[model samples]
Target: MKMMYLRRLFTQELCPVTHTDLMGCLQHSPQQLQQLLSGGFAGAPGLESLSWLHNLAPCFPLRGDQIQVIHEPQHFYQTLMQRIRQAKKRVVLASLYLGTGQLENAFVQTLRHSLQAQSSLRLNVLLDFTRGTRGVANSKTMLLPLVREFGEQVQFSLYHTPDLRGMTKRLAPPRWNELLGLQHMKVYLFDDAVIISGANLSNDYFTNRQDRYILIEDKPLADFYAQLIERVQEFSLAVSADATEGLHRNWRILPYEGTKEQFIRLAKERVTNFVQEAYQRQLQRQELDTEADTWVFPLLEMGQIGIHHDSVVTKQLLSNCIAGSRLKLATGYFNLTQEYMDTITHKCLAQCSILMAHPNANGFQGAKGPAGGIPAAYTLIAKSFYESLVRRQQNHRVNFFEYQKPGWTYHAKGLWYYLPNARLPNLTLIGSSNFGERSVNRDLETQVCLVTDNMDLSQRLQAEADRLYDLSTTAERDIVQRQVPRWVQAVVRIFRNFF
Candidate 1:
């Protein structure tokens, strides 16, 4: 009965083309679509068999050899430094904020030297305004020296969310203000190569914090993200060193040239239009690489500014998971949006496994005050989700695991999809989203859905997923609930969306 329902759902809602028409529309053959519709595609149906997703976003084709999955934090840092040092054309970095640490200082020095060496090289950086200017000495202060040295060649923008305005903005404290919203996309671009990661430019991210990173050496893909960041900087605040201050070295901030309403409205229209036009261009392209074994679909979610391509694509992907599908999802923060949880438990028939941080492994494990209870709050959220699964008798189909390394904190967040009875994942989502409410409704997030038919890339992706899963232990609801305080549970019940 479920299979019949899924088939009907696919045909009625997802199928936009007949078999013959689909052959011309998708990179896949019509036989693959037939197999997917009939539930008989070899061992299992891979993402390549899904034609709807390809149609929903702009698809860029590239070879599997162009991609590299970096597993360790140290390697990610080293690769980033090396790429920055070698960059000759341009370097663009977008992160939540830059950390004031030795490693970060070194990173900035490397950029300075790169700029000193190549006069033609340009650098563009985008960071959240609230978080960047949080303390007396912060990310803004760290970058002002570079601006003073290089002027327009070294430009940075601080994005301020229009959500936290008026009385709330004044009353909100320093560390807590970031909970309202943030600029959370993390993209590091150097010349024609780009590294997409959830890790920030911090000492913890460079040392023991666990996260995912994917390096793609493709010019078109790099240019796409570069342009996307440029669009975001259009509405952000610019930083310039004050020449009149001279020895004082004072810096000035030039705010967006309009009211908050105007900024929000104009930024939304420009970003949404840019994405739609890119999608249309991809759809109309007649020279796409038909023989390419790998394709990338970029998903952008800026719900605060009203752009939600990522959310729409993610919901559709989850809702269309038929029987025999396997999905592995990891989020360091375990607060799944209610809609996502409902679709996984009640709508989808895929066998799903969720990996989240154990209380001991949470980044906020040993913090002070209410911030320290964050681990417990996440436990409460997970308990609620677990109860929902039990009520629907879906706990058997979906399992939970907690990642707890001895001395490390877990911050990895993404999704990996495996075809039934398959040992490897054919598709993966990697980026800065934790799938929490804040990601959905507050922050700006971006992730890419990578669909590959190349066996080598598939193997590498599966290995990355396996490594994380190997360190995780099965989560028991009662055990997790025992650690949650009553007060924490009450807090979670009241302000569930903020986390």
Candidate 2:
């Protein structure tokens, strides 16, 4: 009976609509999609086909009930606090940096209180060295108190990218050095549950910045991330607070025993071996959950260190989108790599909808100096991409939308793939990647490709996509072309990769 249903789901005859253009292809409205996916079969055939991704990464099987998608920023904050309070064994947090704000203070206090209460609880934090140590009272200073109090119970690692070294590292200013690379993965693990998001543990992320967050209550997934974090920590600097001087102490440690080249070589070897071992083990596992409707493939892209598994998987996924299928992509940054642009416009036959932040909705909209031109630079990039789409005559199948909420800044980044005639996405890529040149070739990035056959989870995914789309407006090529300044355009042309 299940095999028959699967066959029916995959057949072209079952689909009610078929066309080459976006409007004609995706006949069902978001409302209709929601209704169609609300309840039905226990499994999705479209998602099952994505099992091939396991060859690239370790695949974790999960039930639909294990996943929870948090929509609001406040709720996400509350949930993290609640999970920390309830945590018994371990709490691992990896973010770009922790903001210094009232809420962030409370967040640190919560971790402190949790450690004070639970005797066996351990805490591990990881942040980018440059970003965490930016200001006088930054992430490093904020975390020093915990280090002073809990000692070994609480530990943190500052991951400094080896790419920035010697003369370049010394000459580059505080904020500018971050352009080289960063530790950009965001994973918050509390014991057996893990919350993956693109948002940092900052005030804006906790309040108004729009981003995607998913809480998965599975022990294996949590353990996997915990191990991954530990591996990164091995290649990161340890933090220590001075007994009397408090925050005045300098935190530094060479990840490897030798030079920057040696560090990169050793770190690459370790990370590569770790991923390969996991993949081999996954291949050997014969007993997987037969009833499990969801599978997650964790992808890591440390291009600076020469690991590009995530980029490979991402490109493959984009290129494999069949005709009549639909792909909705959202990125806070509008600068996509040339390969990604070419894949979408020329290679992929799927009707694509890209959602990006408007100039006003960009997080860098009100910066003081050259940083302020970032929003405009992104607009210029978008304009060029739109022109390419038009030049290739792919505008009918590919479209763009700008996310512009009144009070919120857009920071969501991910991809959702829907099979032909399907009301909900069967697969989704969620994490810290913007799918830009930096993400592909410079930074340390990680994302999970969630392939789920469960209708309930699919409905939630569809609803999340709908909510973002609802707040967005169609991208007009003429307006985009006119919005950028001449200076911004020139800067973008010369420094396109850095964006």
Candidate 3:
């Protein structure tokens, strides 16, 4: 009940009322609140001073870092390969799955050459067990060959996030737990440089699909990400080259502690401790990095919602939406939580635009058919969500868009917020997070919240935003409503949370 009250209070309904106007009752104006949060309200009086929640929030910012945004997959892959080859001391790579394909083979061959060239170099590859163990159609095992060659030269680990699905476990087939619960984060770190992306190491992601990419060259930031991998590695299982005993031995088999909720809470605590420690370490190292002029806040939402309950990314996003004077967001998927939807329709903003993937622009559209496959189903469901927003009473206040490009799939995801009277976005997020229920309540997500006072950086980000808007087609309500079949809308309504 207390939590429920807090949610309502934060909503800030603007309709004139008697005693129900919470903000009015508290004598707090939204403008004043925005001022308090424009630069992140930390160390303030009351609830702001609490360390437990403050540590989790992306409230603090780090400065003096060179940042670059990469969108072209071919260019991204080439740059990544270059970084891998140039590594000196250590290279840490983590992805949900290092997919099987020519792309994966290239990466493997590169690692081999790097190891041969430099004997002392350290390489650590972490992956989600459920995904890493799987093979593509008519392909050999993904990681085993690499493990065989590297042996103990390279470290291989699998993050097997415990599955306490209980009765729901029966709903899925064999290996259901693997599919349902996963470590969805994607990170790439090499020495003092890091490439943060939502894209997986696959040919499709490399050649056709589009995903947000941000490169930061700062050892302090690199150390933080590397440490995150190390901490997860501590909890993860180490894979071996032996196929016989390796399968059974690589996964950590922790017994059920209590309810799934209890176990998730414990896991959240562990993750939070690591994050707090990394943040403190970065703070200490910040003094030495003199070139960092832009502020970067690492945002993490690392657990299941009902079970673990650290919606740091979601909460911070909501705060930004309510606080920012203008907002621009791009996401491949269109599904949105009620809170987000409300924020979009209600924010006291001068301008707002949302870019989403068109039905044809879906990465899996080629695999989908009229009879309906996973890709077709998801696109249909997303259209329904888009329709809902189009029909909103405040729809006129926002502009909707879908990217248009032949033979290319849209996978971009990020948010940009402009402060009042500012020409460029003062705050932005870039990484693996998508704006949807799965990202908000289910998946393990990571994003770097970049807040900058540097005018040059803001101008560059504005140019990116302009390009995104320019490449998109303005979504018309009439056109969308006519295209989607009514039956699909019903289905979307029934299973809205998954998207």
Best of the two (2, 3) by TM-score? 2
Off by over 4 Å in 2: 1-44, 243-258
Model 1 regions more than 4 Å off:
1-48, 243-259, 477-481
Candidate 1 RMSD to the correct structure: 6.2
Per-residue alpha-carbon lDDT of model 1 for 1-499, expressed as tens digits?
2222222322223333343443454354455455424322223235545656655566777888999999999999999999999999999999999999999999999999999999999999999988999888789888889999998798788887877777777898998888888999999999999999999998999999999999999888898899899888877777778622111122222222236666566777667667666755664555536456788888888878766667666777788777898999999899888989988987877899999998889999989999999998888888888887888889899898999899999999999987667688878999999999998888999999888778999999999999999999999664445567778878988888888
- Per-prediction TM-score: 0.89, 0.88, 0.78
> CA shift at 127, candidate 3, in angstroms?
2.1
List clashing residue pairs in candidate 2: none
Look at candidate 3 and give me any clashing residue pairs.
Answer: 64-292, 64-293, 65-292
Which digits, one per residue and each the tens of the lDDT, describe model 3 over residues 451-490?
A: 6666677777788777667778887563355455566567
TM-score of 2: 0.88
Q: Once model 1 is optimally superposed onto the true structure by TM-score, how far is the C-alpha of residue 381 displaced, in angstroms?
A: 0.7
Tens digit per residue, CA lDDT, model 2, 1-499: 2222212222211221211211232345454333224321124444544534643557777888899988989988999999999999999999999999999999999999999999899999999999999989899989989989998898788888887777888799999999989999999999999998998998999999999999999998898899888888877877876722111123233632247777777777667666666654553454445577888888888888777777777887888898789999999998899989999887898999999998889999999999999998888888888888888888899889999989999999999999889888989999999999999888888899998878899999999999999999898664455667789988988998987
In order, candidate lDDTs are 0.81, 0.81, 0.62
